[model samples]
Target: MATPGTLVLAGTPIGRVEDASPRLARELAEADVVAAEDTRRLKRLTTELGVTVGGRIVSYFEGNESQRTPALLEELEAGRRVLLVTDAGMPSVSDPGYRLVAAAVAADVPVTTVPGPSAVLAALAVSGLPVDRFCFEGFLPRKQGERARRLAALAGEERTMVFFEAPHRTEAALAAMAEAWGDDRAAAVCRELTKTHEEVRRGPLAELAAWASDGVRGEVTVVVAGAGPEPGVAADDDSLRAAVDEREAAGMTRKEAIVEVARSAGVPRRVVYNLVHSKGPR
Candidate 1:
């Protein structure tokens, strides 16, 4: 006659420990098992928060996730409340947490969230770009060709796009984005957000690329404006697909080209994507 256990996904402060919610503090102190992305960082956070962790601390990161998931589920099945947290932000967002969530869902285990600060939202809020409709692209592929393909896929996206990049690769990624998205595309580079050195640089992609070329430091988040309407192109499926085809042939990706084509043809990007992938040439 034991109560069913619940899994709690807690969002930690991205920076500034004061941002930690009261619920986070209560969960950290009360959960039966606490799974953290980095135990060392978790200890530092708890120390900063001046709160003591009463639950058993366990490491749950990319490297050990597969091996540890089953064990965590066992604790849950035993009616032990398990709290999942990442070093920053919510779990499963370019971080560890997806697999366990999927497994939990499959097992019908109850899952809940304690939302808090997020780099994605924080960046978008200060990005000076349209936030009403935006897309989170997380981190792009590392290889040059792969990265190009990814950017090209998003070429015509009209909604603001947010991305996470390593400081070392920001310049190159910006450069590639400039080429795929056009040099004139407006973008914002948020560095060390919410931290003492937090900086937001807004400009065209080309300008951002030039600035980053000298090298930058700290965590980085990028927000780029979506493509504007193109003149002259008729708003028909045929013209749209042709436009995308032309861009792709010129080295743009089908994804990137489709967006650009959609913008030009005055159609939703999804329509273009569907037409571009729809079996045969139109």
Candidate 2:
């Protein structure tokens, strides 16, 4: 009987090539069709592994993923053991190959994975921050305003956050994060992980932003501490009103003013608003 068709989604080394798993090398050498995000990188990896590709190879990157998925799926349906790889890390985690994997699954083709290195987990593990509850935010939007807005939305998020960023924009992103999440928030910038010049810089957001201002290089992963506990409540109604009035005087609208006082005083917004209205101005 002929071998059943299957789709293998393999994880490549995020940094050092030595991190590649034995199973990855074997699959690459034996796959009947290899779809890679970067054919050049795939070729180099195969050469480094001393594993000759015994199958047809094709490019499948962000630009060509839509066009390539169907073609790769066709190969899989034809009883070809199609193996998908990305430039780095797992194929489909902030990389190409997800669509192809989904297609194979819908078609009832066997789907499997060759697990290996991951920058997200690596950064989280080394970061002194809590990793018990976290979320992978992938890469932030490139536009400055959009990125700031996205970061602002997460200001109240209680879970630790992981983000991938380019070297050149790391400083700007860190600065925006500081503005949205307070300068004192703790964070770590992990650069060139697993490589000879690997570095993990940990500090308050402001300090990390300052370091990156001088310019950063290599792949970067950032792990940030989650929002801290809310502050203690104001001692009395007079103190809470004074806080709200101070915020309102600073040009914040009434609702914004109330929210500010609530967050700072660790009181509910509705409660603050009721007190302000009951006290009737001043």
Instruction: Give the alpha carbon lDDT tens digit for every residue of 134-174 in model 2.
Output: 99999999998899889988988878899999999999999
lDDT of the candidates, in the order given: 0.87, 0.86
- lDDT value for model 2: 0.86
lDDT of 2 at 85: 91
C-alpha RMSD of each candidate structure in angstroms: 9.9, 8.8
Models 1 onward score TM values of 0.81, 0.80
Q: List the residue pairs that clash in candidate 2.
A: none
What clash pairs does model 1 have?
A: 152-256, 153-255, 153-256, 155-256, 156-259, 156-260
How many angstroms is residue 126 displaced in model 2 relative to the true structure, after the best TM-score fit? 0.7
